[model samples]
Target: MLRSSNPLEPTTASFGATDIPRKPNYDFERREREKTKAAESAKKAQAKAEKRAAEKGASDADQSGGS
Candidate 1:
């Protein structure tokens, strides 16, 4: 019987060959990141708008009370 020097090489003929793992999908990962980023941006924008509206309302009330 012949023996392979490399440890990675399968020794026995009866044993099935090992399948290599699939490579990472960079495009899919990038798209997912972009989606999360867009969602966060939208959320921040909404909060900012709400804060601006509240400040505007407060100022208007203050002006009316002062007059």
Candidate 2:
């Protein structure tokens, strides 16, 4: 015999989730600072590489026989 499911019944367990201890001093500001620094460094490196490539292209064009 098949039993009918109760829609109102609690399916999951009521564990002590909210009872978890939090950090005494969370340095989210420091994490954001580091993230921004890393992003800026990457952007600078990308720009430098692009500039070098453009210089190289100009030099190659100058060296080529045909204009």
Candidate 3:
């Protein structure tokens, strides 16, 4: 059996070199979530405004046609 000559050298696992996991960036993740929420809210608000405008126009047409 071949063995490492230097005891101080790092030993490798049978699979390969061990990998250290990266730490999560909570601040960046929070900012991204906030941005997505804001965009969705804006979209919903725009749709609601368009629906209100359409209803108002239809009501005006009905009143003029009935007169």
Across 1-67, the per-residue lDDT of candidate 1 in tens digits comes to 7589998888899687678898999999999999999999999999999999999999999999999
How does each model score on lDDT? 0.95, 0.81, 0.89
lDDT for model 2: 0.81
- Kindly report which residue stretches of model 1 are placed more than 4 angstroms away from their true locations once superposed: 1-22
Query: Model 3, stretches more than 4 Å misplaced?
Result: 1-19
Ranking by TM-score: 3, 1, 2
TM for candidate 2 is 0.56
* TM-score against truth, every candidate: 0.65, 0.56, 0.67
Clashing pairs in 3: none
Q: Ten residues in a row with the worst lDDT in model 2?
A: 8-17
List, residue by residue over 1-67, the lDDT tens digit for candidate 3. Answer: 5457898665554646457888999999999999999999999999999999999999999999999
